[model samples]
Target: MQTTGISYSETSVRGRSRPSSFRQRFKHSASWLKGVAVALTLGSLLSGCGVVNHMIYKTTGDVMQGFSRDHTIPYLMASGDLAMGCAMSEATAPLLMSFGRVTNEPDQLAVMLYLSAGGCAEEQGREHELAALAAMYERKGNAAEDAIIRQKRAYSLAAKRYLKGWQHHNTYYGEPGTGECPDFDDDMDEFIYFAGLLAGLQALNSEIQSTSSIGVPKNVGSVVARASSCLESDKWWGAPMALKATVWAMIPGAQPEGEDAFERLAMTDRMGDEAGVRLSHVFHAIAATNKGDEAMVKSVVRQHAESLKEQPANEDWAFVDAMATNMIIAISDRLWVENTGHRTPLGRLGTFWDDQKAEVETMDLDGLL
Candidate 1:
């Protein structure tokens, strides 16, 4: 009886040991699973930060792009302050451009901004050109050479900015006049397209002026000339025809026989004036300057000034009129500076330093004093 009791006790002990071993194995597995879960959670958190950052950056980029297209561009277009416009473009370009990393680039805005910035640099180049010319007139050989170098440097910078604008325009719109002009999303889109053409033309012009190999396409002039036809000359305030005409006048063999470039420019000048947008005068002056026809440039500037006096600027397009005025003034200033070693005097845009003084009886100022 004692032996049997001992055997039962042994069986009970074995059964208890089996359960204890099973519990130990289950506890170990649970602990392993917990550790794996913690590791995965930490890993996911570290990686998820990048994903979250990407999303946030993309959203911000999109918002900025939208705001620029909807509000900023229109405001700048409507404002007549060319200097302010230039400043705005230069100041905001880097911040705006950096957003391209996480989102689509604001290419249309880039076209306008770079174009404006290039204009600012071109203005500086013009100043240098005037200084160089004045130095030559004064027989200051070293000064003239130095001024020329400065002018070329400014022009090279202008060319690079303008070419960047042209590149962005091409990337956004594809080659202008691709199968046909791409359907413009709106009037603003059409305007942007027009701006792009101007950018390309300016790029080529500035590159030539720089006397540097800027890689601006030599064919850009012809391309712009052809692309100008895509815009309605009348609808865009005669700018398109003026651009085409300027290109025709500038490029060799570009003007179709019997279709006189100057004649077309004259017609467009009238069209521009009648439309209350005097942009055509700019083209006329540019063509005349390129031809070295100082008389014609003077005539164009005089006509523009007279037109301003006769007609109130179109309220809706006042900014464009103001831009034309600014460019004309720049040209007039160039002439004045070339002759007098200074820019045009206040309220003397139409008159030159050499203009004949109207016959006046000499007042004896000494006796009066």
Candidate 2:
């Protein structure tokens, strides 16, 4: 007998069909710091750069250093937000490998995508910091050359990391030994597109932040092409499933032509769509984008904050929302910070910690469900 709900695996909806079994089927499918002694030894090594003996950790290591180490790792492991934290860390694994860290998690490939998304965030943050860095250099006129070099280095880092993220993502998980990703799962596609969106945003952010503007990175083009391919095939199902695709649709250069556009995309199923007022805010945030809708954005963000407070144990959804919320909040915060220099506590939290707070918050879900 056919299950009552609309099948998640189906590409398109005829009208109002029951939700799919795959939603629950795949739903079932569902990182460590060094020791203190190891910490002391590494700290001494990281203190200096010029010496060959200098202990250079990975790009992640360096960035992580600026935050509160004790709290960061634990925070990332929390529930509902675990996938995002894993994704963020996995993205930087390649760079971290250069520093001699090793990761062999069963879900390494999936984690890689999430981590890459996180890395994209890091790259943008660095770009935003560049304008400030350049101004500082100008004031210290004596070190103008040094400032230029630093900016170049920063740009290169963002570009390089972005490119690497693109490489791992392009395989479509088709790479041998990565796991069996025959075709693409709708849920999987949801996460993949999220990563791609983050990548595209990073590319745009780089251009916006740079002293000399460059055209969008090739990865942006690749991502857009892939997203178009997904839509043309009608590869996703339901509202939540469609949200990622809809988000991609909004990307500046995603598709040259499309019917319905925002209205159609907004109509798709959204997870937690029935969760009442809590979800209204979430949906509002998702829907408010690119419309110069500041009021909607703030409303959604505040609603999300309220939801998190009520359901401290909302590990599964919390983790999911963490990534979603962080992306919206991060971009929103950057714009406000860059243009107005005014920041809310959450925005400020992101700027100072590079999404660590969000990651740490997820850690609380570690053993929950």
Candidate 3:
């Protein structure tokens, strides 16, 4: 009775209700929705492949290398635990070398690997230099004719290792026409580039300290000057500035008009503070030491200590942070070995041993003997 007349909403064909046709259309729509969802899922995965690969490579390299520097080596070095540091370096050497060997094509990761390898070589050179210093100290009072010979030999070995380090770093950048210098889209490229420059600087320092006649290449300075401009706007402003300051201080009459090297060194502190990396302090201290400016050295060292106290933790770039700490500690180690026959005091590596004195005091061995 209620359906005596067909409702306007109902479709009829040949006196038959078309409810089945509606069902068929609904089914077709459901299939189309499913296909659309599958297509979207595939598209998302395809679009994310490059990003995923990049992340994987970056994370792997950082974690492996960072752990070696931050957790294993620096702590060992700081605590005067060289045995373990050497062991760790040896164990990791093969793995690090493998990265270089596997890559025939130049890439960002390749550059990082080379830089890390160069760092390893540089550290080895430093160990030799320390050994030579210790040898000199051993013959401090005795008239040992052979002491000079031994020290010279050690210095020569150190210089060779440093040269090797420089060569490894030069593989990525610095050479006029040889290096790949591949473009990268992240902070790592900057870090690697800066590291290369640092290697060149260290190589030059090693040669000078060893009294070697080997001259620094003219192109090294040119490359550093050109590359530093790129780092000025990033978190690494302090690094390039420090490099410039170092170059100015080292080269005879190289300082530009109205530009003071010491001031440039000081400016790095603020930039480093903002970026949470104080490696510039190391460069500052080294340059000051080379100039025999004890006052400036102490000031920078004190500032470094205070900065460490303020930020005791390294939340990012642990490797670099640890390297900075290691370098500062090494400075303290040198002072202590020459004066006190020990490494730095437990927690006073960066601070001046005596604030009233501009120069480090040597021990009076006459009374102790």
Alpha-carbon local distance difference test for all models: 0.88, 0.45, 0.61
By TM-score: ranked, best first: 1, 3, 2
Tens digits of per-residue lDDT, candidate 1, 1-369, equal 245532221325534644456667999999999999999999999889989999999999999988998788887777777788889889999999899989998898899889988988998998898898788778889999999999999999999999999999999988975557877898889988988998899999999999999999988988898888889998987889999999999988999888899988999998888888899999999999999999999999999988888887776567678888988998998898778777888987777777877888888889988
Question: Candidate 1: which stretches are off by over 4 Å?
Answer: 1-43, 358-369
For model 2, residues 1-369, the per-residue Cα lDDT tens digits are 777854255545686444567566555543113355677778777665434433333434445432312344335524545445656565555554343342222232423443445454454454445445444534654454454555555554554455454445554444322233335455444445444444554554444444444455544633443443343223222323343444444565544455543444434322232331122233345456556776656555554555555554334334444544555465455445544444435434223223335433336666887
Report the C-alpha displacement of residue 104, candidate 1, in angstroms.
1.3
Clash-forming residue pairs, model 3? none
Tens digits of per-residue lDDT for model 3, 108-219: 3333333444445445555554554565667653333344444445445444544554565556454623334546455555666666666566656656555665555645
Higher TM-score: candidate 1 or 2?
1
**TM-score, per-candidate, Cα-based:** 0.84, 0.43, 0.61
Q: Between prediction 1 and prediction 3, which has the larger lDDT?
A: 1
Model 1: colliding residue pairs:
none
Candidate 2 residue 149 C-alpha distance from true site, Å: 10
